[model samples]
Target: MEDINLTIQKGEFAAIVGPSGCGKSTILRMIAGLETPDTGEVLAEQEIIQRPSPDRMMIFQEHALYPWLTVEENVGFGLELKSVSKSERKTRVESVLKKVGLDGFQSYYPSQLSGGMRQLGLAV
Candidate 1:
């Protein structure tokens, strides 16, 4: 992974593909601020990423939603952590759920939803 210079434009999706242990996850971890490069820097939007940020998230292929929380709770968890007002959080969560076609499933738990629905819940 030495001298790896990559630029991912905003709104542009990129994928890193390679054999196992070839540092693909390491690169993603660096970008997510979960790991630090010993010799180089990882930047997002021109800012050096030194810690985990709400603006940046790593949603693994597996289900990452909290099993104990309902869909609405899982979707609003980040906003809750940021101290967003309850009303605002509700509004935003409802908006996102509506957009994702999960508006009526807010009370459902992760295990209750289908695989695709669970993934969408995680994405929200």
Candidate 2:
């Protein structure tokens, strides 16, 4: 992973593909602020990423949502951890649900959603 220089623009999508143990997950972890580089630095929005941030996230391949929690609950889990106001959490959850076409399925559990829906919930 030496001398790796990459920039992902806002609204742009990028993928890191390589054989196993090729540092793909390492790079993602650094960007997510879960890990730090030994020498260089990782920056997001022109600010050094010193720790995990609410604005940065990583969605793994497997379903990460809690099966017992409803769609809205799972989507708002992070906000809940941050101690966001319940009213604001609800509003933001609703907005994101609508954006991902899961607006009316807020009460549905993860098991009730299809694979694609579960994946979208992860992104939410």
Candidate 3:
């Protein structure tokens, strides 16, 4: 990797548009702590990026929604892994599903959603 410099402050929305295999996803993965750099660093809150944390999240071009999980299940997947409580998880999953326009489809599986819907599901 070259010495590429990038930064995004809180509440910022930045897009790294690029052709296929041009490292856009690589950069994102690195920033998400999914990939490590050989000769550089990734910092979050002034600390070096180490591994996946709730404070940082990533949604790839290919939706990572689990096939067997219902829409609600997938949206709350992360919080579930973190052992969030039932009511809190339900509230969060519902809120995000509504935010992504999947409010009525929470019981559906990824296989039932269109590509865009799946992408939205992954995003939330």
Off by over 4 Å in 1: 76-92, 95-101
Clashing pairs in 1: none
Evaluate all candidate structures by whole-model CA lDDT and list the values in order. Answer: 0.91, 0.93, 0.88
Q: Each model's RMSD to truth, in Å?
A: 3.0, 2.6, 3.3
Off by over 4 Å in 3: 66-68, 75-101
The candidate, 1 or 2, that scores higher on TM-score is 2
- The digit string of per-residue lDDT tens for model 2 on 1-124 reads 7988999999999999999998999999999999999989999999999998979988778999999999999999999999999999999999999998999999999999999999999977
Give per-residue CA lDDT, model 3, range 4-117, as digits (tens): 899899889898988888888888898889999888899998999989886777876777888999999988888999999989999999988887688999899999999999
Q: Model 1 compared with the native: what TM-score? A: 0.71
- What's the lDDT for residue 50 in model 2? 91
Give the true-structure RMSD of model 1. 3.0
TM-score of 3: 0.67
Best by TM-score: 2
lDDT of 1 by residue, 1-106 (tens): 6889999898998999999999999998898889899997999988999998978877677998999999999999999999999999999999999988999999
TM-score against native, each model:
0.71, 0.76, 0.67
Candidate 1: worst 10 consecutive residues by lDDT? Answer: 52-61
